[model samples]
Target: MDGKNALCRKCQDRLWDTRIPASSCERCKSYVEAGGVCRFCKNGGMEHIVSTYAPFMYTGAARTLVMQLKFRDMDDGLAYLTDAMADALPVRDFDLIVPVPLHARRERPRGCNQAQLLAQGVGVRICVPVGNALMRFRATSPQSTLASLRARRSNVENAFALCGDADISGKKILLVDDVRTSGSTARACAKVLLQGGAREVHLLCACVVWHYKGNEKNGSVAGKNGAAAGQHGR
Candidate 1:
């Protein structure tokens, strides 16, 4: 499905399109560039993440697609996300792919880990092996409940731990997720990776949360608008 060509023209329109405007800083997917760098990237990104890329803005159709995948368990749109993520990725030479893991309690009810599903999709596209390297050992309040960046960081702080002896020594790792807002979650995972001996950790997501920190949650019940044509991957 490209643009308005698919049978579900309305749903297709909600996915990646080449016509959408690209952000100024290609280094870190930012919609608004201030002083040559995205405001968040300037203040919070540079020192922690090597780079982060997301092809679509966190609004409109993009949000709809993500909402469907996460809440309604509609994974058919994963191909679209994989296409967008694969296209936006800056480098392909990565040793391993990892996803922001869900807590055991959270994942049990959700059925499947949305971020893990996304990471697997990206790994297949990029020809890299994926590992569930990190585990959410400490359950924290959802980032959506947090109001500020500090709160979000504190919520996820020290929440992740290495899964096992997945040797990442000096190897570059990619952290996959559905959306990135304040980046506290991604940064928290990356910190553990670096401390565990990963040479580098990069973040990649389907959409970039820009300007506003909306109540963003993955695999949680949200506004369900489209699910007729998006049930599960074939």
Candidate 2:
């Protein structure tokens, strides 16, 4: 428990007075380990997206790390994202890498977009950030609260729009994101990219929440149970 490294979001107390992997919550006695999704967010189709090449699950030390990365501005944590991105979906020759942008309200407070930070970590030549490339058209209830998959999809339907500057008619796009709870967000963005003129839009993320049937056979999700990616492919 490193106090400087491990700070409880709930209590704001430093763990072990030094930075170290957090084991348990000092206040609630709950475990704060990595590679696990919020047990609170579990039961509702919130399993480890896919063990294979998924974004680091939010459990144990991994969870704590992402928390610090996303909310606490541990900008350096982004380095970890680089390997994950390359391993999750290797981009051999993508014309551009576009990170899904957060709403202005959310981005203003955080002063940054986690997905964009991740894209930077990917170590590829950066094109325009295109923050306005996909506008969050309307605010909706947090996805965590939506228990039904249908509801989740609807919550994001028509919630995104493409930028006027984008020209994808023959370009290949690699869209990046921090996490993928449901394919809804990525799908929405991909639709817009395709309509905007993108010849191919590949969705890449730190993690993919739930992989479907075809994912395994196509190098998408190796094996049914899911494991870290072995070889990166489109």
Candidate 3:
């Protein structure tokens, strides 16, 4: 769009408009019924995270963009994704930006980590440094293949370890990922960073799965600006 070869103007507009609505949970930004408790918060494991930010809901054109980048290895959409993510940052003084790690086996086949790509783009935009602070030492089932939230959580539990020589003591960190579904993966990674002496860990994702009440189908599955503009707090 806009003379870019990544997406058409119509697709770009559709992706940009897929922002999470005010009806979502105040803390985690997942869609919730009016006045209902946020299940992501009630489920716990997010106390280590300070806040979460994302630009679009995981549906429609947004999903397509994420799939293209993640599965198909098409990174043409990185510019658009990082632009939204940078705008979604609430604070600009983060000490470091860290991407959720993928086991070597998984990453070797892909030849690149989408999360790392997003992190590098965001780091450049925000004038922050990006590092490989954590390593996924254990290979686990993909969170998406799991049917339940507990299964997803269990899949990533203790799967991440802080890398040696990566001193994060008292440093604020921005954790980047492509998408957040059950939030299990982000919470798991955040716990590791916190235990490794990170002063604060904030989540930034390209898209987050949105749940709606009833049969309200907002859009098809597919896959931000400003801290106050997109931050979701607990």
Q: Which candidate gets the maximum TM-score versus the true structure?
A: 3
- Candidate 2 similarity to native, TM-score: 0.62
Cα TM-score per model: 0.82, 0.62, 0.84
Residue 212's C-alpha lDDT in candidate 2?
30
- After superposing candidate 2, which stretches have Cα over 4 Å from the reference? 1-55, 123-132, 210-234
Where does model 3 exceed 4 Å of error?
Answer: 1-6, 33-37, 43-45, 73-75, 213-234
Q: How accurate is candidate 1 locally (lDDT)?
A: 0.69
Candidate 3 lDDT over 65-103, as tens digits, reads 876787675556888888888887767889999998889
- RMSD values for the candidates in order, in angstroms, are 6.6, 11.8, 6.6
Q: CA lDDT, every prediction?
A: 0.69, 0.50, 0.74
Candidate 1 residue runs with Cα over 4 Å from true position: 1-9, 16-20, 212-234
TM-score, structure 3 vs. true = 0.84
**lDDT for 109 (candidate 2):** 82
Worst 10 residues of 1 by lDDT: 225-234
